[model samples]
Target chain A: MATKTKPNGKSEKNQPQSTRLWLMFPPKLITRPIVWELGQKFPLVTNVRQASVTDEIGLVSLELSGSRGDIKAAIKWMEKLGIKVEPVEINVIES
Target chain B: MDKQTGFMKALKCRECGREYPLAATHVCEFDFGPLEVAYDYDRIKASMTRSAIQSRSKNMWRYRELLPVAGEPTVGCEVGFTPLIKADRLAKRLGIRELWIKNDAVNYPTLSFKDRVVSVALSRAKELGFTTVACASTGNLANSVAANAASAGLKAYVFIPSDLELGKVLNSLVYGANVVGIKGHYDEVNRLCAEIAGKYNWAFVNVNMRPYYAEGSKSMGFEIIEQLGWKIPQHTIVPMASGSLLTKIHKSYQEMTKLGLVSDAEYSVHGAQPAGCSPISVAQKAGLDFFKPVKPNTIAKSLAIGTPADGFYALKVMKETGGAADDVTDDEIRDGIKLLAECEGIFTETAGGVTVGVAKKLIASGKIPANDSAVLCITGNGLKTLDALVGHVGHTREIRPSLREFEALIEAETKSPTAA
Candidate 1:
C-alpha cells in the first residue's frame, strides 16, 4: 500500500500532499469547535473518516489534503491546542 | 441467505448514526465511528419470541435471530452451550450467597469464549463471499479462527505475537492453518495486521468482521439468562480484553429484556483485568471516561490488549448499570485459578483467574453485595496456558503403582485413614 508521506524525505514547497491522521482531543478540547476552526483556518481539505465524542474526550479519523507545509502547520496548530495527533496507519504511513 | 436479513437492516455508525449497506465493513465512511449491526427490533419482536429461541438448536445459533448473520450458521456448529454450573462450594468460599459460573473454559473445539465470536465471524465471512480469513490475535482468537475456518473449509491466516504460548501456537498449526508470528507485542502485530487488512481482501475476524463477530458473545449472556430460568443475575463479572465481551454481554441482557425473555431487573456489570495491563480498571477507579493506553506486561497474554478498542464503551456500560472495574496481581490470579479449581472443580485460564480474583476482591470490599446473585464469566480453559501453574499446583506424592505406598503416603499427609 502506498503511504501519504512525502517521498525522498523531501518535497517541493508548492507541491501538494495528503495524509490521514487520527486526532485525539482531551476533555477540555472536546467541547471546543476545533474541527470548524481547522477547516476555516487552513487551506486544506478536511475529510473526516471517523469520530467518537463523549463528555470527556473526542477522537477523529481525519484526512487532510494540501501542501506539505500547510499540513505540518495544521498539526502544529492542533498540538498547540493540546490535541494529540498521530498517523492513522502508524506503521507504514507518516503524518 | 437467511430470512433474518430483514431483521438486520443496515450497519449504523455508533457515533454519527450513519448507515451503510450490509457488507464486510467495520468503520463508517464519514466519521470512522464503529459500524454496528442495525436490526429492525419490531420485526425481531414479532419473529423472535421466548418460545421461538428455546426451540432452536443448542449452540450459539439458538439466538440466531439476534445475531448479525444473514442465514444458517456455516461453522462452529458445536460451539457454546457450555455448562452454567451452580458453583455452590465456590460461592460459599467467595462469601457470596448465590453464584453461577458461565463456564466457557470448556467451550467446544477451542475451550475459550473466542469460539463464539469466531463462529459468527466465519459464518459471516462465508456469507460475504470471502475464501480466506485472518485475524490479529493474542492466542485464543488465533486458535479459534484456525480451527473453525479449517473445519468450514476456508483458508486461514493467523497473525500473532511471536511469544504466544506453545500450546496456543500448536493448536493453530494442528488445524492446518497458516500461522505467522510477528516479532513484537500484540499491539505491533495488530498495527501490521491493520495495514495488511487494508492491502488484502481477507476477512479479518476482529477487524473487518467485528460487527458480526462481536455479536456472538451475546450468546454467553443469552445462555446464562436462560439457564437461570429466564432471569438476569443481579451482577455479571467479566474479563476485559479489548473490552468487547463485557459490552456484548451487557447488550445480550438488554436484547433479552427487549424480546420479553427476561424480566427487567437492576443488574450491574463489572470488568476485570490483570494488574500488569489494567488500563480500563485504572480509569474506572479514578472515575475517568477514557483510559490511557499502556504497555502490557502480564502472564495473562490472552487478555493483554493494552489499548482496548471498546474500553470506553465498556466503561459506559459499567456506569450505566451502576457497576465497577478492578484488577488482580499475577500472584492473585494464580490463587484465583486454584481457588476455583479446588472449590468448584473448574479450571480456567488467566483471564478467568483475573475475573474470579476480582470478584473476590469486590465482595471483600463490599463493592459487590454478597447477598445478591452474581455470575462470573470464565472465558478460557487453564490447559491453554499451563505455564502459569507449572510450578504452582503439585501432587501430594509421586508414589509408585503400589497400594501400600499410596496408603502410607496418604497416612503421612493426612495423619491417618480415620482422621476424618
Candidate 2:
C-alpha cells in the first residue's frame, strides 16, 4: 500500500515559484529586521527590490523565491507578526 | 481576421519587452507587467496635425490615431472636449499666478471623465466581437460603462461596492445595466471581477481590456494641451483613485512632445487623495517608490481605491516629473468642493474637492509655487454625491409667500452683523 498523502494533495507544493509582494511595516515593527527574520524562519530567498523607511512606517517591495508551500507558510508568519503583505499586482487585472 | 489596427503597432508589456497582438489582454504572462498600447508615432504624426484636429469634430475621437480602437469610434463619439475655464477668481483665492479647470464634470452621457474611457473600451469591445461588457467600478466608472453599453446596445454588468451613494446607484440602474452591488469594498469588487473576467469571455473594460481602456484617459490630457494653446501647464493636479489618470496624463504629454504636437517643456504632475484612504499620497509624502494599501473610509468614494492599480507607475511619474502628492481630510474635501463652487461656479464632486484641496495645500507649501501656473483636473460632477453635502452646504430658510414677510426677513438680515 502507498503511504497516505495530505487530503488536499497539492503534489506540486514543493514546486518552486517566485512572486513579488509589497510588505508594509507599522511603527512598532519598523525597527525589527523582519526581512532577515523572514529568511531565517522559512526556506526561501528574499530580495528587497525597493524599500523606504521612516521613523513611523516602513514600506518594502520584496521578491521571494521558494517552494509554494514554504512561501505560503512564510507569508502566514509575516502576517502573524503584523506585516501587511499584498501581491504586487493581480495577475488578471491591470489598472 | 486581419482587421485594420489603425495606427497601433501592438500591445507591449511595460515591464518586459514582450509584445502581444492587439487583443483583449492586459498583463504579461511571464512578468505580470501591465501591457500598454504601442502606436506608430511616425504614422500618427504625419496624419494627426494641429489643423487636422481643429477641423475634426469637437470630441475625443478627433485624436483618433492615439486611441486604441481599430477603426472609427462607434460608441460615445460625442464625448470629451469639455471647457477649460480660466479660473481667475479661483486663482486669486488660492494665491496662484494662474489657474485653469479642465472640467470633465460636463462630459457627455456621463458627468465624469470615465465616459472618455468607456467610449474607447466599448468601441474596442465591439470591434473585438464582444457582445457583453463589464467593469469593476466605484460608482463613476459603473455609471459610464452602463450608459455607454446601453447606447451601444451591448449587455453590461457593472460590479460596485454596496455602500455607494444612492444617486450614483440610481444613475447606473437607470441605464438598464446589471449593476451588481458587492457586499465589500471597491478593491474586493475589483478582485472578484478579475476572477470573473478570467472565467468568462465577456469584455471587462478595466481588466482584460485595460490597455485600450486606460488609453482613453489620454484624451483629457490632449484636450488640456490643446485648450492651453498647444502647451503643457507647469503643474497639473489630478485626484488619484487607481492613479491611472495621473500616469496616462503624463504619458499624453510625452506622446505629444514626441510627436511634435507640443514643444518639449517642463511640467510636474501632482497627485491628490483623501486622507482617509491615501495609500499613494502617503507613500509619495514619505518619498517612497511603493505604496502601502489602505482600507478606505472617506466621503470621496469615487477616489477611494485602497489598492490603486497604477500606484507604482503613478509614483514613478511624479518622481520623474518633479511632482508631489498630498491628501486632505474629509472636512477639507468638503471645503474644497465649496471653494470651487463658490469661486469658479463649478460644482464638483469630492474627487474634485481632493484636487482643489491638494492644489491649495501644494500652493501654500510652495511645492506648486504660487507664482507658477497650474491646471486642476475636475473629473466628476457634484450632483452624484449629494449625500456628502446634505447638511454641510447650508440649509434653505423657509419663507411664506408674502411680500411683507419677505421684506421683514430682508430687513432683519440687513440689520444683522453676519448678513454678509
Best by DockQ: 1
Q: Which tens-of-lDDT digit does each residue in B119-223 have in candidate 1?
A: 999998898899999886667888888899889999998886787667667888999999887897343454467657766999988777878888899999999
TM-score for chain B of each model, two decimals: 0.95, 0.97
**What C-alpha lDDT does candidate 2 achieve relative to the native structure?**
0.87
TM-score to native of every candidate shown: 0.85, 0.85
**Judged by DockQ cut-offs, is candidate 2 incorrect, acceptable, medium or high?**
incorrect
Worst 10 residues of 2 chain B by lDDT: B185-194
Chain B in candidate 2 has what TM-score?
Answer: 0.97
Q: After superposition, how far is residue B365 of candidate 2 from its true place, in Å?
A: 1.6
Candidate 2 Cα misplacement greater than 4 A, ranges: A1-95, B1-3, B163-165, B184-188, B417-420
lDDT of 2 by residue, A11-78 (tens): 56676777667678988999999999889889899988667798766878787899867987887788
